[model samples]
Target: MVAMAKKISKTVLSRTDHLLEVRDFVSEAARQFGFSEEDVANIVLAVDEACTNIIKHAYQYAPDKEINIAIVRNNGTFEVKIKDNGKNFNPDALKRPDLQRNLTHHRRGGLGVYLMRKLMDKVEYNFEAGHSNEVSLVKYLSKKQSLIKK
Candidate 1:
C-alpha cells in the first residue's frame, strides 16, 4: 500500500511579519502527516528559516514581494517547497559556519542554511535565474515514528 501525495500551499508577502503565519501553516500540515511533535517542530523551524532567507536575501526585505510555500506529503516523507521570484542565490555556495569563530565574534546571522540542514533530512535548491528560486526541505518518518503513529 503506497501513500498518495497530499499537497497544500499558501502565499504571503515577503516580510518578517508573515513568518508566524508560515510557521503555523507548516506545523499543522506536518502534524496531519503523522509527524511527532518534535519532528513537527523541526519541520516548522526549517520552513521558517527557508522563508526568512527568501525574504532577506532573495527579496532583499522588499515587503511587497510574493513568497509561496507548498508542502507535499507522501510515503512517510514530508517535503516543503518555498518559491520566490526575487533574486537568485546558490545554496551550494554557502560554506559551513565556523561555530567557534562566530561565537567568539558575537556574530548574529549567516547560520540559517546550516540550521535548516541540521533540522531537515534533506535540503535542496533549484534556481531559474530571474524567474524562480525554490528550496525544498524534506523529512522522512523513521520506522519508530511510523509504528508509533500506527
Candidate 2:
C-alpha cells in the first residue's frame, strides 16, 4: 500500500517580517511528517535560503508583491515550491564558485545557489507567462539518504 501525502500551501507578503512565519511553517510540517529536529532544521534552512534570495533579488525589496510557498510530503520525500512575481532566473546559469580561490580571497555572493543545490536533492526554476517565476526543491527521506538517522 502507498502512504498518503500531506500538502500545505500559503502566501505571504514579500517582506522580511514574514520570514519567521515561513520557518515556523516548515517546522510544523516536518513535525507532522515525523521528521527529527535536524531534518527539520535542514528543511527550514533550505527554505530560508530560497526565500532570502527571492526577497533580495527577486522582488528587489518591493513590498507590493507576494510570495507563495507550497510544501508536499509523500512516500518519505518532501517537495517545496516557491513562487514570486519577480524576474525569472535560470538555475543552470549559476556557476559553482571556485571554493579554493574564492574562499581564500573572501569573495562574496554565489554561495546561496551552491548551498541550495547541496541541501536539496533537486532544484528547478520556471517562468510562468513571462510574469511569475517558480522555484521548486525536493528532498528524499530514506534509510540510506535520510537526513535523520535512527
Candidate 3:
C-alpha cells in the first residue's frame, strides 16, 4: 500500500523580511512528515535559498510581487515548488560553481544554487507562459533521516 502524501502551501510578498516565517513553515511541515532535525535544516536552507533568489533576483525586490511555495511529502520523498511571476529563469543554463576557484576568489554567489543541488535529490525549473516560473526541489529521506515511528 502507498502512504498518503501531505501538502502545504503559502504565498508571501517578495520581501526578505518574510524569510523567517517561511523557514518556520518549512520546519513545521518537515517535522510533521517525520524528518530528522538535520533533514529539516537542509530542507529549510534549500527552500530559503530558492526564495531568496526569487526575492532578490527574480522579483528584483519588487514589493508588489509575490512568491508561492508548495510543499508535499510522500512515502520517501519531500518536494517544494516555488513559483514567481516577476521573471523566468532557466535552471538548465546554470552551471555548478568551481569550488576551488570560487573559494579562492571569495565569490559570494552561486553557492546557494550549488548547495541547493547538493542538498536535494532533485532540482528543476519550469516556465508557464504568462503565468509563473516554478522552481521545484526534492529530497529523498534515508532511513536514518526519517523520524517516523515504526
Report the candidate with higher lDDT, 2 versus 3.
3
Residue 23's lDDT in candidate 2? 92
Best by TM-score: 1
Tens digit per residue, CA lDDT, model 2, 17-127 = 999999998778776676667767888888888888888888888987899999988777888999999977666776888888787999866778888888778888888
For each candidate, give its TM-score against the true structure.
Answer: 0.90, 0.83, 0.85
Instruction: Give the worst 10-residue stretch by lDDT in candidate 3.
Output: 141-150
Of candidates 3 and 1, the better by lDDT: 1
- Give the residue spans of candidate 3 off by over 4 A: 1-5, 99-107, 144-148
The residue pairs that clash in candidate 1, if any, are: none
Residue runs of model 1 more than 4 Å from their true location after superposition = 1-5, 103-106
The lDDT for every candidate, in the order shown, is 0.89, 0.82, 0.85
Candidate 1, residue 16: Cα displacement in angstroms equals: 0.7
What is the C-alpha lDDT profile of model 1 across 1-150, one tens digit per residue? 656348889999999999999999999888877788999999999998999999889989989999999898887889999999989988778888888988999975668999999999999999885779999999999988888778
Rank candidates by TM-score, best first.
1, 3, 2
Task: Provide the lDDT at 105 for model 2.
Answer: 95
What is the lDDT for 107 in model 2?
86
Q: lDDT of candidate 3?
A: 0.85
The best-first sequence of candidates by lDDT reads: 1, 3, 2
